[model samples]
Target: MADLSKDYMSNSADPKNIQDLTTFVQNLMQQMQDKFQQMSDQIITRIDDMGNRIDDLEKNIADLMTQAGVDEHV
Candidate 1:
């Protein structure tokens, strides 16, 4: 069989091929970063919404306690 390594080296030596490979890698990295950023944003939004819901629940519970004439410090 012919020297496959030599053939690969020759093909890889072409500047256009190198540029194309670099561009492909950069684009792939950017896509992955974008996906990660989107996921992070969604996680943060969900956490904030959960915090709001917890706060509302706490407020409602406090209101119920007051209606029953219970002291808050008790």
Candidate 2:
């Protein structure tokens, strides 16, 4: 039977493998952060759009009230 300890020892002593693993983890974390930021930006944009639409609707209602001679302050 072939011994496997030597293989494990050799792999553990290699710094290149560790560096590669570290780089991979860093890239993954960066991608996750970027995606989170993109989603947050989208949510903020939607909220802003909804606010603008609500404002327009309120203005339209006020205009309608004025046309009908309805008192808006009542």
Best TM-score goes to which candidate?
A: 1
Rate residue 40 of model 1 by lDDT: 100
How much is 44 displaced in model 2, in angstroms? 0.7
Where model 1 places Cα greater than 4 Å from the true spot, the runs are 2-4
Candidate 2 regions with alpha-carbon error over 4 angstroms: none
**Residue 13 lDDT in model 2?**
74
Error of 2 at 29 (Å): 0.5
Per candidate, the number of residue pairs that clash is: 0, 0
lDDT of candidate 2 over 18-71, digit per residue (tens)? 898899999999999999999999999999999999999999999999999999
lDDT (Cα, 0-100) at 6 in candidate 2 = 83
Give candidate 2's error at residue 67 in angstroms.
0.9
Give lDDT: candidate 1, residue 7. 89
Indicate the TM-score of model 2. Answer: 0.84
TM-score of each: 0.89, 0.84
